[model samples]
Target: MSAPFQDKVCLITGAGSGIGRATAVKMASLGASLSLCDINYDNLSATAKQCASTPRHLDDVDVGSKQEVEKFIKDTIGKLGGIEFVFNCAGVNPTSIPLEETSDEYWDRLMNANLRGVFNITRGVIPHLKRGASIVNVSSISGIRGSAQQAVYCTTKFGLIGFSKCMALELGPKGIRTNVVAPGYIDTPTNAGIVKGGEAVTRMINGNALGRLGTPEEVADVVAFLFGEESRYMNGAVLEIDGGIKMSSTTSSGK
Candidate 1:
C-alpha cells in the first residue's frame, strides 16, 4: 500500500519542535516532501534529519516577518516545485497572567508571533496554491471558548478561524480548501511546567473528559488526514483535537 501523502509537497512552519515537528515526522514517513522552517536552526535541523529519506529543505525563518515569509514561500516553490499542503503551525503560548498585569510588549509579542505570523505566511502561500491544495491553520481550544488569562491569545486564534473561513469562501471556487484545527492542552515542551504534576495541573488534567494531556503526534494524525484525499470534501471546517475538553466545558444554557 502506498503512503497517504505519497509525492505531496508540504510546507510547515515552526518545524523546530512540538506539533510542527511531529507533523513533519509523520508526513515524512508517509512519503511527503517537505519545505520546513523555524527560528531555531539546531532544532529544525534535528527535525530534518529525523525525516529519514523524505526530500526536504530547512531554513531558519521567522514567520512573524512578512519579508521572511515571502522569501520562504518563493524558495519553497523553487525547491519543492509547488506547495499542496500548507500547515500554519507556528505560534507562541500566551502568558498566563491577568490582563491588568500584561504589558504592551507581551501583547505585541504574542500578536506578532501568533496572529501576524499566520497572516504573513498565509498571504505568501495563497498565490502558490492552485487546485487540490489544502491549508490547515493550527488554533487552540481557547479560541473556541474563553479562558481566564488568555484574552489576547484567544483573539489571535479566533482571528485565524475567521481568516480561514474567508480563504475558503474566496478560494473555494478555485478548488482550494482551507481549514483550522483547534487543540487543547497538548503535551508539548512549552507546557512542561503544567504537565509536570501539581494540584492545579491535576485539576486541569482531570477536568477534561480524557483526564489527561494530549500528545503532539495525536494531533498530527488528524492533520495528515486533512492534508490528504481522505478529507477532500472538508473545507472551512474547524476540527478540535481536545479529547472532549471543549465538549465538557460548562455552559449555562445547555446545562
Candidate 2:
C-alpha cells in the first residue's frame, strides 16, 4: 500500500534482462514512472509487460551510440516530463583472452559497449536531471580488482568507476547524487557461461564468503536503496553486492 518511489521518474538502460530488468520491476512496484531502454526488443517488451500497470515508456536502443543515446534521452524526457533517477546497466561481458591475443576491434567494442555507453547516457541526461536526482551505474568487481584474460573488460569497468566518481563530484553540488554498484558473480544471463563451467565455477562459488552467487533482485534492492531518500547522504560511493566475494581470497569468481 506504501510506494516509496511514488511520483518519481526513473530511466533504466539494459532493461531487457539481468539486474536492469530486476531494477525496472522494483521501481515500478514502488510506484515510479519508468522510461526503459535495451537493444533486445523482445526481452525489453517482456520486462515492460511485467510492470504493465505502471506508467512506462520503452524503446530498443544501443547505449554505445551517442546519437542513439541522445535520442532516447530526449524521447524519455518528452514522455515522462523529467527524470529523477537513472540506472546505467547497459553493457556487455567480453570473452576471456590474453591482452596480447585481444584484437584491437574487440578491445574497442568492449570499451564502447561497457564504458562509452555509460558516458553517452550520462552526458545526455545531465542537462535534464532534476535537482536531488540520483544515478546508479552498474560496475563490476573487476573494476576494483584485476582478473585473468579479461584485460579489455576490466579496463572498461575500471574506467566506469573513475567516470562515476567524477560525476559525483560534478553533480553533487547540483544536488544530484551519483553512485556505483560493483556486483560479483551475479547469476545473470551475462555470466551464464561461467555459472555452468563445472569445477572452475564451483571453486569460484566457494570463494565468496557467502559461498553462493548473488541474484539480480538482491542487487536491485541495494540499487533501490541508493536511489531512495534513505541514502541521501551517500555520494560518490561504490557499493559491492558480491556476496562477500571482494573480501574472500580463495574464490576467483571472474567478476
Candidate 3:
C-alpha cells in the first residue's frame, strides 16, 4: 500500500536533531520528500541518510538570517517541485540564570534564534506553499507557563504562539493551515547531558503529572497528525504535548 504522504514535499528547519529530526524521519517514513535544514552539517547528513524518502536537499541555514532562509526555501522548491508542509522547529533555551543576570546579548540571541527564525522562514515559504499545505511551528511549554531562568526563551515561544495564530487567520483563506506544537522537556542529545544527574531533571519530572520527560518521537506524532488529513479542520491551534504539565496546576490547586 502507498504511504499517506507519498509524493508530498516537506521542508523542515532544525532537522538535525531533537524534535525536528524526529519529525523529518517520521514524515519521510510516510513517503514525503524532505528538505532538511540545520546549522550542523553532520547531523543533517545523518538524518538524511536515515530517511526512507530521499532528501531533495540538505541546507546549512541559520534561520535567523532572512537571506539564508529565503535561499533555503528557494533551493527546496527548486529541487522538490514545491513545498507542501513546513516545520519550523529551530530554537534555543537560555541558561538557568537570574533575570537581572541575563545579558542583552542573551536575550537577543534567544529571540533571534526562536521568534525571528520562524518569521524568516515563514515569510520565505508562504508564497511557494501549495493550497492545503500545513505549517507547524514548534513552541514550548515555557511559552504557555512561567519557567525559572527561561524568561527570554519563554517570551519568544509565547510570541510564536501569537504569531502562528495570526498567520493561520491570514493563511486560512488561501487554503493553508498554520498551527503550533508546544512540547515539554524532551529527551534529545542537546539536553541529554544536562538532564543527566541534575536537579533540573528532578524538577522537570516532579513538575509533570507523568513524572517523566517527553520523547522527541512523542512530539513528532502530534506534528504528523497536524500535517495529515486527520487534522484537516485544525488551524490556528496550539496543541500542547507536555504530558499534562500545563494542566497540573489546575489539578493540584483544586479550586
Candidate 3's C-alpha runs over 4 A off are 192-196, 246-255
Candidate lDDT (C-alpha), each: 0.82, 0.86, 0.82
Question: Residue by residue across 1-255, what tens digits does model 1's lDDT show?
Answer: 468778789999988898999999999988899999998999999999899688898889988998988888998888879899999998887656779988899889878988898889888888888899999998887778876677877788888888899989998899999998888777777653354447645655665778777889998998998988889999999998876784554210000
TM-score of each: 0.93, 0.95, 0.92
**Candidate with maximal TM-score:** 2
The lowest-lDDT stretch of 10 consecutive residues in candidate 1 is 246-255
Cα lDDT, model 2, residue 33: 95
- Give a tens-digit lDDT track for model 2, residues 1-255: 779989889999999998999999999989999999999999999999999998888999999898899899899888889999999998887577878898989988878878989999999999998788999998888888887788788888889999999999999999999999998877777773465588757765776789887888988999999999899999999998877774544233222
Give the runs in model 2 whose Cα sits over 4 Å from its true position: 192-196, 246-255
| Over 4 Å off, model 1 | 192-197, 246-255
> What lDDT score goes with residue 37 in model 1?
95
Candidate number of the best lDDT: 2
